[model samples]
Target: ETFVSRMNLESHPDQPEWLSHVNASVLKVKLAMAIIGISSIHLLKTFINAGNYDIKVLMWQTIIHVVFLMSALAIALTDRLLSATHAAAKAGH
Candidate 1:
């Protein structure tokens, strides 16, 4: 909103006043995902430092990878959904 105002750009007719709040929410979600990714990296590093090939260690590693992969897939799906919505809106349909 500030940038748009500063640039003297007109806002979209359909754009909600709450759009800034929505953007903040999206930023929070992205930050959380980033923290999760960083934590997963550290977790894997910790598992590696254990230097063990036991069943428990293997299970932990597999679980971590699965969780991270799922989160990534979820993010991708969400992005696609948002992109599609934006495209539809832009097409004025």
Candidate 2:
């Protein structure tokens, strides 16, 4: 409502509002997935490459990595879903 009521591009290519909305939705999802995937991979490689540590230290590091990965993944996915919901609602279909 705000976009339509406030952003009237009467002379710029005449693109439908839905196109802009869907593109924003896709961009958001892609940006989120990229960030999450890269971060997860980087963290995994960091732990994997940290070899030769003592058993106790390694176990602690593993536990920490698992907890962090799960937390980050859950938060990212939840946000992705919420963004999609907003994008769909904006489409007015």
Candidate 3:
């Protein structure tokens, strides 16, 4: 429900003051984290049923999991950088 409200707030043109307090970068980071979590679950399930899967399938799942992790890391780092830059700019004003 909160996620849906946030999405609606982002799309609305007439945003309230509270909307300004909600950082979009934070939302992006959260979304990335959710993706990583889902990926991890899928990878874990694959590992548990390893005998049922081909070697190539296991390898691809691992590679995909690594990619999801890397993507999440990148999103978090980028959000941190943007937040720092915004803070600096505000301080300079």
Candidate 4:
């Protein structure tokens, strides 16, 4: 709903005044979380069927999962910092 509303507002010329204040970073964070969730599920499935996969494949999957986790953490941290900075700027004003 949030994304749909944002998209709708973006497509129209006469958007509400508050539309400018909407933080799109939240959506990015949510997407990052979803990617992490999907990566976790894939890793879990691979683990569950360990016998079907080679050890090298399992290791690679684990490495990929870790990379996804790190990427999500980086995105979340960046979003937090941006939000804090934005808030501080507003406070200064």
Candidate 5:
């Protein structure tokens, strides 16, 4: 609530008319990421418990997981940046 109040008081410099508001799409994406991240952690633990650990396989899995997770995060951030640019343009900034 305090953050929202402060944001309302400080309009975008380039587009004074622009107001910060809750973005449902962004929230949904974040929620999905949290779910997937938690599930991945649980699966990793289960894999370890299975006691058939192969260093080669585990290393590959870890690498692939990190790559995909980073890519997803990059895409999400890029989407946000693009949306902000578009909004500024629309506001005649």
Candidate 6:
């Protein structure tokens, strides 16, 4: 791909890695997911108390939110498990 070729050419071969790559990628997803989760809670609450929105629309929205939020949750959960395993290996029990 063009993007990959450009990055490979630009990056120095001796470049030392930093934490930004992981932090930036993970935190971006985390923040997005947090926002989605809050929105889902708000939507569910509205449907519960107000009962003004159409049931079909609400159902669709809830399903979408669940799917999106689940994706974020899955990524975060996997990261945590991997980190735990890494720590355990480092600790060497």
By TM-score, who's the top model here? 3
In candidate 4 the C-alpha lDDT for residue 45 amounts to 93
In model 2, the runs with Cα more than 4 Å from the true position are 1-52
Q: How would you encode candidate 5's per-residue C-alpha lDDT over 45-92 as one tens digit per residue?
A: 857765676777677767766766776677688878889998999999
lDDT of 6 by residue, 1-93 (tens): 244432352367665575325554488676877889797788878778656877787888778788878878787788888879989999996
TM-score of each candidate structure, all chains considered together:
0.48, 0.42, 0.74, 0.72, 0.53, 0.51
What's the distance in Å from true for residue 89, model 3? 1.2
lDDT of each: 0.69, 0.66, 0.85, 0.85, 0.68, 0.74
Cα error of candidate 5 at position 43, Å: 4.6
Candidate 2 residue-wise lDDT, 1-93, digit = tens:
345555666567876766655654466556656666776676677668667556676677567666666765676677788878979999977
RMSD, every candidate, angstroms: 8.0, 6.5, 6.7, 6.3, 8.7, 6.2
Model 1: per-residue Cα lDDT at residue 57: 71
Report the CA-based lDDT of candidate 1 relative to the real structure.
0.69
Q: After superposition, how far is residue 9 of candidate 5 from its true place, in Å?
A: 32
Model 1 per-residue lDDT tens digits across residues 56-76: 876776687678767766776
Give lDDT: candidate 3, residue 66.
93
Which residue pairs clash within candidate 6? Answer: none
lDDT by residue (1-93, candidate 3, tens digit) is 364533566667787877666577778877888988998899999999999999999999999889888988998888888889989999999
Give the higher-TM-score candidate: 3 or 6: 3
Provide the lowest-lDDT 10-residue window in model 6: 1-10
> What lDDT, from 0 to 1, does candidate 2 have?
0.66
